[model samples]
Target: MSRFSPFSRSRAPQLLTEVLSRTDAFAPLRAGVEQMSAIRRDLDALLPDYLAASIEPGFIKDGKLALFAAHNALAARLRHLEPRLVADLQARGWALDGVRIRVRPQAVKDPVPPKQARMTPVGAAALQALSEHLEPSPLQAALAKMAARHTKR
Candidate 1:
């Protein structure tokens, strides 16, 4: 197939690989991404399953590895394991100096809960009764209005 074959005929993975590798501008970025991915795999292999899932590997700069945790609790756990982790990484051939753990919570889209009725039916009835007993005034009017809102037809 021609190098410029239509996307319909060429697989996305092959096209992406070709573009990332062939472009001089993308070569360094691709290499950096690959290195980070490799580091992440190694880190995950060394960590416990629960910890591994919450930790993300960042770039290694100036002989130090940057790690991102899902929350402060995980970051604290990582800090406690920093010395051991650094040693392990060094043993695995990384010229590591220290570990930097930063909390970077993942974005979660949680649906808002439906609002609950603030005034219960019984409370509404009580307000209505109190308003009826009170003389005609702003307070009585306000109470009656609020009760009307909460009471069922």
Candidate 2:
């Protein structure tokens, strides 16, 4: 019979860090990712809430910062703000000459419409009967109104 041993679990972040640190080939890639993330944070801070939420930071190469907008409208808006954004980023210690905006629409699934509660004819009749038995109170009035509304559908 062969003996087997269970594998120990390791955290994904720790494992990824170890791999990136030990591999020289991944150093540049890791650096690029960290730089982009930092730039993204800074950009988000400088942008308006609506624009920041719709934009994503891309690569920075040759003194130009690339940005991805959710759609053409957003891209146009970003282009309008590009000069001011570049100056702000420069003030924040980023050596930016210009910004390039690109439209990259994200895949968003259409939300399923909520199922509306529908009252049956019998249920409406029951509510009407119950309302009639009760005195002229707010609850009775509401029930009658609901029954009348549902019965018309």
TM-score of each: 0.61, 0.66
* CA displacement after TM-score superposition, residue 121 of candidate 1 (Å): 35
Report how far residue 35 has shifted in candidate 1, in Å: 0.7
lDDT of 1 at 31: 83
- Model 1, 40-131: lDDT tens digits are 88888899999999889988888889999999999999999999999998998888899978899999869999988598788999999999
Q: Candidate 2, residues 5-105: lDDT per residue as tens digits?
A: 44554545665556777878999978887888799899889999999989889888788999999999999989888889999999999988999888999
**Model 2 local distance difference test score:** 0.89
Alpha carbon deviation, residue 128, candidate 1 (Å): 51
Which pairs of residues have clashing backbones in candidate 1?
A: none
| Predictions in order: lDDT | 0.89, 0.89
Superposition TM-score, candidate 2 onto the true structure: 0.66
Identify the leading candidate in terms of TM-score.
2
Error of 1 at 71 (Å): 0.4
RMSD of each: 12.2, 5.8
Clashes of each: 0, 0
Which 10-residue span in candidate 1 carries the lowest summed lDDT? Answer: 8-17
